[model samples]
Target: MKYDFIVVGHGLAGAILAETLRSRGSKVLVIDEPKENSASRVAAGLLNPVAGKRFAKSWLADAFIPAANAFYEALEARYGQQLFFHKPIYKIFSSIEEQNTWMAKSAGDNWGDYILATHTQSINQPGIDDPFGGIMIGRGGFLHVYALLDLLTEDLLKQELYLPERFDMDELQLTESGVKYKSIAADQLIFCEGYQVVHNPYFKWLPIQPTKGEVLEVQAEQNFSPECIYNKAVYVVPEGAGRFIIGATYDWRNPDEEPTPQGQEELSERFRQITSKQFKVTGHWAGIRPAVRDRRPLAGTHPKYKQLSVFNGMGSKGVLMAPYLAQRFAAALAGEEEVMPEIHIFRYLSLYYAYTDQQNQQP
Candidate 1:
């Protein structure tokens, strides 16, 4: 095989992993099929560590956030493109209890430098509906995920390391050495096909519960500063040029990327709940997130085939976690380190066994 590894899908996870491997001197070929509703393309790409109604910090936030910033910074330096932003996020307190919790956490210096400013009263931003006040979190921001993907795709194409085609499983042939797909052979193949992995015969048992989400790009009457992100029930991210990204509505039952009226209404209402700003709905888009049952990434080699592997299930925290996890996975693939056990594929080995057993019983 001419390629050391072949990566399927060019979304956020796949692109990062391929780049990590290439940086470590591995010959990589990335095959991608363009999906209009790719989550990475439409993602708001927040880098926030503080999350949820509970106002608790994200898991490994202190570690992952810095890794992501450094990774994106390196990419920007190489590509000469601004792919990352270091905007402060203002999380509006929903109730007194949440505000008090922040107070307690702040007293313990739990947030470190990530906490920029805490207002006992409203942050005093115009049009904001923060009656209880808000917390400005620093050392975090958002990633230009779409831009990063485009830059990587262009680079791959220039180097003849990228193939633009849909992966057809029927054409795949596993061998004693590795595997071949449509005459292209590699030492190993990793699948990062996102929510579509359910259709992959080899990875059928991966517990990826696809969740459909919709986001709206609204044109605010007053331009929101790109230096800050506002969060309430949902997040309102400034995209420069008076455009803001208001999202997202989560639907697990239908994992397709079809934008609906209900989603638009829900997003619009949620934005209203955070502020009294009127904005024109400029764009509406949707994508399916490859959220796992346990809310963690899925990595490591296949149980039955050493030549096959998967690197996906980024879920909602892709922007914050992908870079760190990608490097970790690359090291694991090279046998230089062990993959995070909590997210290793072996965790779901029983699911694969049960699936195979059912198939055998049917015959």
Candidate 2:
């Protein structure tokens, strides 16, 4: 078998990359071993334009947001399934100072565009504690992560472009002209293995800090608005019916996917702080996010092996970052453009060279 590219992993990054490549008329094959704990499977699919405690606009919101919306919308239309839901995110102000800060920012130029309107009343109904009021944000919502992955996988299977198997590095042979992995030959091999890249001998030197996060699905007695996301100490987004998705707890020390008692208690405490309503915890999920020290995605071909490339490290922002970044990567692969300087794999060449020099000298 031969292809223009062999993409490892079927997560959002890999799926979007494969789709983009195929749209450009390239032959692509995707190899993935399904994992019960892959981050994409466990993601809440939150795409917020303004995030974090300071409520700063997300990095490159202008570009990433529209690209993401268009990408997800296209996927939804092709598959005849509802995947992306455009909803407003109502952020509960934690303090009077925070409320004042939003007021000032809302008066600013770009911030005003993102700021739909401010409310002085509690939008949480009876269960939520929003005495300081909340602000509704625009151009942000959630993606049905698992549904999108499943639909994409089905399409690849029908096209005979997907292989449900693990890619073994031992079976791979890097030739002068291209790469050979088992029976398949390709001009280039791109790895989008997410946090599992730690095991890839060829690209393991890339610093990928995998953090474990946990989220819960619960049925609360109160009716939260399904059209908007309620946030404060913890987020409770209505997931149809009487169920709401409450997430998420971040832990750097542990990478295990099993829900922890500590994580549950912490989330419960935060949920309580945000809402006074009682809820029944029905489900819990955990997965590792592929974060980086510098907080930028890693893309582009290897310094030593031009035929090998990587596109990973979107971390918690995978929903917002994947589409646009994948398009850029696909363009670079087609030789139509170059990867951005900031997220380019060349940013870590110094470390790669240092590691190579040390290894050669030791042997």
Candidate 3:
């Protein structure tokens, strides 16, 4: 029951961290309750190089994209499962102004490499009308998140490295030697609980503005190539055969992980705008993204507990952000290198510590 590291949660963050640690010859134990609705499980796994309406290249897209692609490719080779797919994204422009904005941005130094100034291009898909036209952004695709998670879980189970239960905080004992959970003793315990980190007493003080997102699985009668992900207001990602994953409505006020009627209605309307073909709703689900106030991931050790750390707050870009940051975190944990200053949780320590200090300083 002893381990070098104890990882809480089995979402992408924790799963990737555990795999990284194990790959480095560390004895790692992953404790998770599959019942919890993790953002990773519900995510469409889209890794878009360009983000937002302005078509801004994603944060650290240059570094993170290559690392993520390499990592997923290696995983696919090791597990004999297709984990990542490299495809283009067809972003439909709404107006002439929008197209102009995209053209200007695409010409800029930052987005020049990823973005291209092109008119609507025909692909092997249902005939959908593009009024203002669309542009294709290269080096984007979807990860088979569910498939990857299943493969990781099965592999971990075969290796007898996973604990299928809710991790109890009360049972955890911290000492001078190390931390103990049940019969296991670890030098450190990292919590990658995603949005659920809001409930963690140690790291909850960090400004984690969790956002609830809802997505739908639709079966389309019209054939669309899975080679590209189409984006309008909502993304229509082909999920093999005659089905596509349509999503998602970002609700900042509502923190519930349960899909709402309003969310479904909004998403359906968006889909209707992009495609005229009929589609059947096959499934609907929701997940709360581990969004932060500044929208940057929070990663570092606990303020009071030295052996405790966190690697959450990837937000909606977990597919692009997780692997690279997880590698950085694992390296930091293994005493190999320092985590980047900007993304490190130490950047927010002053705010979090000041809040905790104010509470303790209260009369």
The TM-score that candidate 3 achieves is: 0.94
Candidate 2 residues 290-327, lDDT tens each?
Answer: 88989999998988899999999999888998999988
* Shift of residue 128 alpha carbon in model 3, Å: 1.7
State the displacement of the C-alpha of residue 93, model 1, in Å, after optimal TM-score superposition: 1.0
What lDDT tens digits, residue by residue, belong to model 1 across residues 1-363?
Answer: 368999999999999999989999999999898776799999999888876765678888877987898899999999888988888889888888889988887786567777888987986677888999989988777888899998999999999999999988898889898989887889999999999999998998999998999999999878345568988888888889889998788899988889999999999998888878778999999999999998889998999899999999988788899889998999999998888997898999999999889888995
lDDT of each: 0.88, 0.86, 0.83
For model 2, the superposed segments whose C-alpha errors exceed 4 Å read 120-124
Which lDDT value does model 1 have at 334?
A: 92
- List, residue by residue over 1-363, the lDDT tens digit for candidate 3: 678889998888788888888888999889999953568888899999888795777888988898899889999999887889887888888778888887786666555546554674433346565677788888888998888888999888999988899889899999886799988899889998888888887888888887899999998765545667889898888888888888788888988889888988898888888877888888899998888888788888876788898988888888898888888888988788887786788888787878788889989
- Candidate 3, residue 353: Cα displacement in angstroms equals 2.1
With a 3 Å backbone cut-off (N, CA, C), the pairs that clash in candidate 2 are: none
Model 1, position 227, has a per-residue lDDT of: 64
Worst lDDT window (10 residues) for model 2?
A: 119-128
Model 3 gets an lDDT of 0.83
TM-score of each: 0.97, 0.96, 0.94
Model 3: ten consecutive residues of lowest lDDT? 116-125
- Model 2 residue-pair collision total: 0
